[model samples]
Target chain A: MLEVRDLHAYYGKSHILQGVDLDVGEGEIVSLLGRNGVGRSTTLKAIIGEVPPEGSISFKGEEIAGRKSHVIARKGLGYVPENRDIFPTLTLRQNLILGQKSARAQGRWSIEDAFELFPNLRERADISAGVLSGGEQQMLTICRTMMGDPDLVMIDEPTEGLAPQIVERVGRLIEEIAARGVAILLVEQKLTIALHISARIYVMGHGRITFEGTPEDLRGNEQIRKEWLEV
Target chain B: MEVFVFSLFNGVLYGMLLFLLASGLTLIFSMMGVLNFAHASFFMLGAYFAYQISQPLGFWPALIAAPILVGVLGAAVERYALRPVHRFGHVAELLFTFGLAFVIEEVVQMIWGKVPVPYDVPPSLNVTAFAWQGLDYSVYRLFMLLISVGIFVALFFGLTRTRIGLIIRASLTHPHMVASLGHDVPKVFMWTFGVGCALAGVAGVIGGNVLGTEPGMAIQLGPIVFVVIVVGGLGSLGGALIASLLIGVLNNMAISYDFSLYPIFSLLGVEREAEGILADLVSLTTGAIAPLVPYLLLVLMLILRPRGLFGTRDV
Candidate 1:
């Protein structure tokens, strides 16, 4: 479980996140829905301590605000950065090893399990990550995080730039992860993707949360949806 | 043929020594992304500490103790000095190391005096170990070769075999990602910096006898070490090894064929006297163009291949 209470974050002088708040219960997939540059990514970054937020970020009831990004990651928080920043020079196997060995996460998805989840990864495990296609890279990034076996995983733009088929696969994968009893904070631009996988949704606009509800409750809520999601 | 064989033998030995210094620089620079100007200064301190301690504890103990002391000192510098400057940016970190070099050189002169300290090779290694092509190879030169090779082997093994080595290799390419995986990155960095300095200190112990122990040793060897790193590529140990051997062999070959190269200068109608500072300088730039050759190679490498021989990222 994770609780981000009235979190504020800035990039230099720009106050990118202003008094934002959200919560995700255990084994639940929560979606933070927002249009471009509305601070959805920043909120995820803040929770992971990459953005150095001011305010309370209690993950599994431990205060983690302003800690080093790596420190927060070690505290059972898995972050899939917006770009899926894979170590390009390393082999997929080596990258996965780094993930598995370093993070304080142990779970059902071992390296072998991860390889089974993404068969393409197993086939290309020995090759450099740089040479992989965009879809394969995304899969590796997601699987690499899963290899760490975190209790909660934050996926930033998992479907961004992905093909429709891969996007669908990622949606299914997210659902599978939630089913495995792990919480997820899905920051997504694609409403359909978020709606398909997430149990709860929050709409964000101008660095503030405007709506929070279940998929059906938010389905026809046109006013807040149009203001935040339509664009 | 006999003189050539001797030169070749000496060349390999000297090259291995250069490799020791360059390897440390390459590791620290490539991994940390900071060209530690104080690296050679640490080398200088190693010589001074050896000279001071050798007076009381004898040469063998000084050789063993000096590098360990330097490693501890290096760890201290990383924790207290480099870590703070790292927050400011790369340029500030560079300038900080540059200042550190100056302070170290000044400190050496203040403590050891302006003159070169008489740090002799141990009597145990004073005699000739072998006669190669009728040239007597001193036991000290053989010792230097053994120590250099030993360090290289140990370093290579330590990097490839140990868990810490694996972490360091991963961090070298993806420092942030490594930290994200939950290892204490700063601690790894501190240890790396310490190891790098320790290697430099070991080089100083051996190199002091080869080139004389002095306050001037740091400045004398500093720029060439830079050349070694630039030519070797930013962070690749393989590249560093190749570059070090290349520079070392080239320097020796240059000495033997100095007059042959001079004729080419005459063919261009460009005499050394016309070339301003090149005609008149004693600071490793003029009379023995051997030392300057590595830097020239480095500049050319930068122009043609900035990523270095095997670097994955920009230099």
Candidate 2:
């Protein structure tokens, strides 16, 4: 479980995260939906300590605000950046190994499971990550983070530039992860995937949560979708 | 033919020494993106430490002790000095390292009195190792070559096969990504800097006697090693090795051959323009511009292939 309350973050005095408050219960799939630059990604980054956070970010029962990104990561929080920051020079196997908390941590996932989940990665295990296609890279980033066996994973736009087919695969993967009892705090743009998979949806506007309810509650609310989400 | 053969052999030896210095530099530059101007200063410290410590404990122990001392000092400098400047960006880090080099030189002068110390080869290695074309090569130079080769082999294995090596190699390309994977990246960086400095220190310990351990030692060797790394490529260790040997052999050959371009011009039946700059350019000898060879190669390499021989990215 993760809880964020009144989290304010800044990039050189330009206030990005004004006061974001959200939560993801254990084994729950929660989606935060917003248009670009409404601080959706920033919220994830602030939670991961990629940017400094004000107020409190509690993981399970312990506070983890303002810790280093690596510290936050070892404390069982996984972040998949929007850029798909795979080590372009390393092989896929090397990248996955680095995702493990220690050199020999057998945690919960294996490289074989990753290959089974997405066979393309196993085929290109020896090649450098730079040559991976956009979709393969997305799969690698998600699987690599999962290798760390985080209790909760925060994914920032896992399907932004992926093909529709690959996007569908990603949606299925998110469900599979949730089914395995791993909570997901997904920052997504596709309203369809969010509506399908998210137990609850929070619509954000201008660095603050504007709506928090069940997916059915959000689907019925046309006014919130028009004002805050749809272009 | 013998002159050519001897020069070629000497060049190989010199090149191996350059490789010892350049390999560490290229790795440091690759991983930290810091062009450490003080690297050769650590080399200088190694020489000085060897000279001082050898006086009490002898050359054998000094060979082992000096590098460790330099490594510890390098680790401290990285943690205390370089880490602070890192936040100010690469240029600030560069200036800090540059200034640090100056401080080190002054410190060396203050302690050693600006004089070349008497750092000599041990009595055991003083004899000739073997005869080359009836000319005996000192065992000391041969030992230096052996030490360099050993370091090269050890380094190659350590980087390719070890887990820490994976972290180091990964950190070079994607530092933040490595950190997010749960590594203390600053600690990795500090160890890298320390190890890189230790390599340079090893070079100095063995090279001090032959090269002379003076305050100006870094100045004499620094530019040439830079030429080695740049010509090889910014981040490619393999390229560094090739470039080092190429420069070393070419420098040796150039110094041996007193060649002027004026004869070629006359052979081609080209009329020399009297009192023109063309006459000045043609008469230049290979020996005269031998020191400029590496720079010429650098410029040519940059113009033709900016990424270098094995480089994946631009410097």
- Give the top-scoring candidate (lDDT): 2
Model 2 stretches astray by more than 4 angstroms: B263-284
**Model 1 misses residue A14 by how many Å?**
0.8
* Predicted candidate 1 versus true structure: per-residue lDDT over A1-231, tens digit per residue: 799899999999999999998999988999999899889999988887667899999988899998887778777888887787787766788778777754455677888877887888899898888899888888788888877778899998988998999888888788888889989999998988888778899999889998999998888798878778885
Clashing pairs in 1: none
Error of 2 at B176 (Å): 1.5
C-alpha lDDT values of all predictions: 0.83, 0.88
Candidate 1 chain B: worst-modelled 10 consecutive residues by lDDT: B278-287
Q: Candidate 2 residues A87-169, lDDT tens each?
A: 88778998888788787788778889888998888888999888998988888999899999999999999999889999999
Tell me the deviation in Å of residue B124 in model 2: 1.4
lDDT of 1: 0.83
